[model samples]
Target chain A: MASTLHDTPERNIPVQRISTTTPMSGVTSHPGLAAWSLGYREWLRFVRQRNRVIGAIGQPVIFWVFLSAGLQESFTAAGTSDVQFLEYFFPGTMMLIVLFTAIFTTISVIEDRREGFMQSVLVAPIPRFSLVAGKLAGGASLAMAQAVVFLALGLIWGMPFPALGLLAGMAFLLICAVALTGLGFILAWRMDSVQGFHAVMSVFLIPMWLLSGAFFPASNPWLAWVMAVNPMTYLMAGFRWLLYLGSEERIAAGTPGLAVSLLVSFAFCAVMFWASCRIAQARVRGDVRS
Target chain B: MRPSPAIVISNISFAYSARQALANLSLDVASGEIFALLGPNGSGKSTLFRLLATLIPLQQGEIDILSISVRTHAVEVRKRLGVVFQSPSVDAKLRVWENIRHQGWLYGLSGRELTTRGQELLAQLGLADRAHDSVETLSGGLRRRLELAKGMLHCPSILLMDEPSTGLDPAARYDFWTYLRQLRDEHGVTVLLTTHLLEEADHADRVAILSEGQIVACGAPEELRKEVGQESIVVHPIPDHAKQLAAGIAQRLNVQTRTIEDEIHVTADDATATIASLLEQFGPMVSELRLGKPTLEDVFVARTGHRFWNRPADGDSLDAKGRANRKGVRNG
Candidate 1:
């Protein structure tokens, strides 16, 4: 190899380690302006993290197939739901899709820190807010997209959907996605290890789904009292009210008020977003005491 | 530009909670020169490098990197500087070319300009052939070379590299430095890097000899050696009582003595007769002897009463690397 390299010395650079000098090619062809571009790049990287978003599609698919099929015999046997059980479950599965996407997005924080990308972000000349907003937007937008796909899947599963119902469902799901992603960031910032995040997820996420009004209506006397206070109940109930019940579902559930649910989600996400920003700032300041 | 200092840290003190890491540490790196911060594992070199990089905030003192105040204008200062951390920074999921291009974009590159410059950089780093390959599949040396490539992608004027040669083969270290020197000479990139290897420091433009949390001496590598003002004398004392014998040598010879691991070191004497006479006088108490010049290692030993490798094992300091490798040979 050295002999060939030495024979063609004039054609090729010398066979020696060389620093990038005299404008090496194949970089971003020009100089960069600022650090907002890092946020964009970070968001691009998040989108390519496939496994995290797959559940957003997969979970809703399973719910549409299994839960809807399981309910046919029950609906026939009890005459419980007037509409098809599959259509009744569509709003619930949409909520589940958001839950899966946003929750898994939290784990990205752990991965970034472990992979050293978090350190890279902290060291750049970007504003702290951009880092927080960028990651949140990246995760939330992807979750919203996955949720949209799930909604389209729900449409194909023999579900009746008015145009207004469909648009309202889409808007509600996006808000839920943005809010849940904020919560995930908070959890990820507080927990350093993947195993720890896993523990929190198993203990917190599936149980929250089981108890909240996603699959079953929270009307079993004592359960209704608990569901009234559950923020996720409000979120799911809002989805139900938007997708199937026209404008009367909130009055029936008594607590899944769209206005109240959106307010609560806004406050929850805002607080979590602020917490993520604080944690990042502390890390940049090198106060890793926590 | 005048040949004033490129960096200055004045009265800097820092700690990790209760553990005091840097105690009023100070140093200067001249413009247009390579300054090596040499110390054993726990000598506080990493902390000092972090302060200069503006990766962490300054708590107690003033720091200036390239005439800009690190605290007052850290972001602006960052624009003038670059850093290659000890840990790898490339995204393993991204291909080699995208990784570089993404970093360039973050700094402001875009459009056809990004494409043209990105190609030129990959070729310059000789990573063009592997441009489409995933970063995880590349060899450690190649990944490290990519990092060095990434650091220079933004064309920052000053660069800080933490253990740039760690885990690299000997030949790779040589190649890495060759490009580094080329960058400095051609593009005037002022470079400050940390290395425990004394031989590596021998080739630096200047060296800062750190022991514990403070810099004991700072100058050109040769100048630091000359500061000791005499050839080094290494002695392995008699029996297991090397401690007592070392004390006696320090007392009688009026020179400093540091028992670094198994060896006892003494300097500041042209002492063929002194050793012969001392061997004759002490007879059975002296076991072995060696002689050398006042290199950075010698300067560190002279000021802190221990060699760089032993600087952290002294119990109060937490130099992580020194503590881990104190039992091995100093150079390793």
Candidate 2:
């Protein structure tokens, strides 16, 4: 049991280069490299954990299919004549896919801290911004990738989205992904349990998405005001407007213009990312509760 | 001039919200030495370990690692320190080499150098063959060895480990210590570890016994035990009469006696002589008697005047409440 590596005759041990006089000095930290490493780790974990992929993509596709089928006959937008409920709900379903992936990816923050992996990352020489950036980038990449798959499915179903519209829709999806993942990071950083995060998702995230005109338009005058104030409303509008870029298709009524929606969505992404970095700065202050 | 110590903790104190975790504790660890912090649960050794690892911020006082201040220069201090936590830090989803490779990126190591260093450390820690295996598939001992490889990947001058032997079996523990000693003797890397097991501390070059957020004793294991007494005598008196028997023995032998649970412990200079007189006087009362050379437990009792595992009154567990009350009375 006490057999030594030095005494193992079968193995050729490398010359022990544990330098004593000259300390290992080439170990310099770069923000970009640090960000890439952390982000890459998230992708590696996501690839290994197959259930997360199924959970993120499967639940939303089920929601889109059933909801569209049930509402197809009765539901109609006030201004649009030919648009069916299935077509009307396509953008929201894509948003749902993005939302689910963000939730799945950012929950790893709490798990890492609990399992002691975050302690090592927090103590690393890299800046806190790198930590925040890497996580958000990885999560956003995952969300955008899943959302694109849903978009392709819609195209194959004869939704007839123009090529220019699809390209513009991808840009909007990336913005929404970054913003949502950043929001998830901010929420997950303070939470100690995944159960708490689930509560937040149900009570806060789901309602916020519902009121953003993703599920249905805010037809009531006061409901319109609430949707106008929601950050997700701008994202939903930007996505809807871009999905009909080169075509004469009438999008859902009452959405803000493309310029205003893009401006507000970009602003929302900046704010969420800023808040995430601020909370991550807590690592330096020792406020990051173990 | 003599080189400064590798780690200098000066008058540091910390609190977790309302509870005081560490008091004005101070200690200096010399270069290339194996120092152990020996304490039981709630002894604040974990708090100290966190502070030195730069995981938690300093509340008061200062800690310097190789002349770099931990409070003001944490990133610098982190660069020179290799920290191994009590819980496993490796990602179970990733292969062993993948875990090391990712860790290497955090420290800015890459390509051939990172691969070479990772291979060297894996071979040295006896995990060369397991490099491609997923961490979740490895046994506890093997997982711990992988953790060591990750910590040493950056070629840190000082290794700070918290309870490195907590879940390991005896054979694995011996192998772990063998690796630690080899690190110190051959590479001149300073090793500071925390443990509750007395045998673990016995293997260290120096041991600091902590109790209730304070250092009770600090010295070599042999010196600490010798300071308590030359020999230890444990006398098991008749059931439910330990207090009375302890008082009788203390007065009869003109020595101090402590009754812990059902046993009365007496540290004597001549245990054979004391046992002879004790049997002649109280053979009918004594159920059993055992003699042994003074151990670290004796030294702990001598300095702290209580058992090592005695928790403070506000500790989380309910089982230690009775002992806590007794300890409070002694302190009061």
Candidate 3:
């Protein structure tokens, strides 16, 4: 490798370098700015890595298309009157996109830790809140962006949805994305390898999504109890209610109220975010191996 | 009065699960000086670097930077520190300018001021032309220059680098050290770097030689080398009679001799006279003879009673343990 310090033509140019005494005057630890930079970096990386875009949005769309098409005749969103599988599964597919995006974005946590980028951030003079908030914001925003694309696709597919209802549904989806991203952050924070996160995704994240009544209605008493305890169920209920608000079939089916669903989703998001912050602040055994 | 030391590490110790990495280590580095922690693999230099960088929490004792306690004022210390890690910390996907911009943001720098500072640093490091290029497109030496540019981007008063010359060619290494010297001399920035290479450590103002988690010797490289002797004579006898030749030479010369691995080392007051006597007395027994001014390696051997690179039982395992610890850090 050639010397970068002395070989260039610019080396002959006499320039006075800034000394440490001045220190880029007025620069200090700004948590908000640091957080914004971190979040923006995630967006930059996402745009550059085309495979990540496809994996997060494309794979989930494929699943939704094939699964809904195959089950359109046999499955009829049991217990809901006159609800077609395509529309009934619309909210679920949107949720799946958010979940996939969460997985893709959060997996970078493990990579950053391994590749030494996290070491730089860990040593920076910023509060742990900035780190956690920045990462969750990035993941949540990416997930929401993908979910919105799916939402647009659903509307174009001719599902009956009012403008006001669709706007409210986007709000609900943003909250859902935040909650799911927080979950991913918590799981990926301590994980050392992407494979370990994948293992966790299959055993924990996928099952959580499956049991949230996104793929099928929880008509069986046992299944209903499971979905009732799952936090994702509230997110799905809140989103589905908003997307189908005032529609004859939705009103007849009678999903959970907006207030109750929002309350539970907000509570879940707070807890997950709080837990991730605690992990980030931990001074022992997490930042480095020993 | 002289300013207080820029870094004060007092009686610090760290250990892995069952193996100790650093024990009761203490040293102080003066401001505007280049201090090197010189050691081979598993000598605890890297562990010390990590603790100082705040990448790992201190296990025991205290480390204060510019009078601020690392335990309580880590963030404040971080503000004063610019660290270049052994591993490449810059994102390869990001353009060179993008990496610098983001680094500035992490330190609360932004907008016009950051752009100007970044540009100035890029020009100084001879990377201005490649500012818009992706980092992955650069060679190892250029990437290292970028790392240096990032470390200095915040205009930190102190710079901490771990194995800064690990992957560089000889010319690049020379350029790197020349720039570091300029930082210390022109900007009055204190530098603390860890290196296993003796030549690299020789460039520091002072070097602390660590062995088995302790500082066996600490001083200027020349002073430490002088402590060994005025000159060093390495006698490599035939393999079959290495032990006998060492004993015979010790008796014949009536001087202290150390037998390390297959060679016998004799620190002599006069190399010319000693070599003549050894050749006359044991010409057929000796296979090779080398005489030179004492080096840091000679100092290390004299202090530790072992070869610098070859270790006893504990050292062999230490290499594996150090590797495993690195893997653990990466895997985690």
Best by lDDT: 2
TM-score of each: 0.83, 0.90, 0.92
lDDT of 3 by residue, A1-290 (tens): 22332333333323345444444322488999888988888999999999898888888788878888998888766556667777777788889988888888899888888777888888888998899889888988988888888878877888788888888888878888888988998888888889999999999899899887688777678888888888998888888878776763563243456688889999998999899899887654546542
How many Å off is the CA of A65 in candidate 2?
2.1
Q: Which prediction has more favorable TM-score, 2 or 3? A: 3
Residues B1-332, candidate 1, lDDT per residue (tens digit)? 43788888899998888888789987777776787998777788888888887777888889988778998987777776767878877888788987887676655566676676667767766678999998989998888878887777767778898888766655666666667777667766678998777666766788887777887887787777777766666676666868887788778877677787667876656656666655766557666665555556667767777656544455423233212212222210
**lDDT-better candidate, 1 vs 3:** 3
Pick the winner on DockQ between candidates 2 and 3: 3
Ordered from best to worst TM-score, the candidate numbers read: 3, 2, 1
TM-score, candidate 2, is 0.90
* Model 1 DockQ (Cα-based): 0.26
Candidate 2: lDDT of B70? 94
Backbone atom clashes (below 3 Å) for every candidate: 26, 0, 0
If you superpose only chain B onto the true chain B, what TM-score does each candidate give? 0.84, 0.91, 0.92
Model 2 agreement with the true structure over A1-290: per-residue lDDT tens digits: 23322233442323233444434542677788889999999899998998988898999899989999999998886678877888888889899888888998899998888777888888788889999999999999999889888888988898868899899989889999999999999999978889999999999899889988889987989999999999999999899889789764568678787899999999999999999999987753223343
Q: How far is candidate 1 from the true structure (C-alpha RMSD, Å)?
A: 6.1
Would you give me the overall lDDT of model 2? 0.83
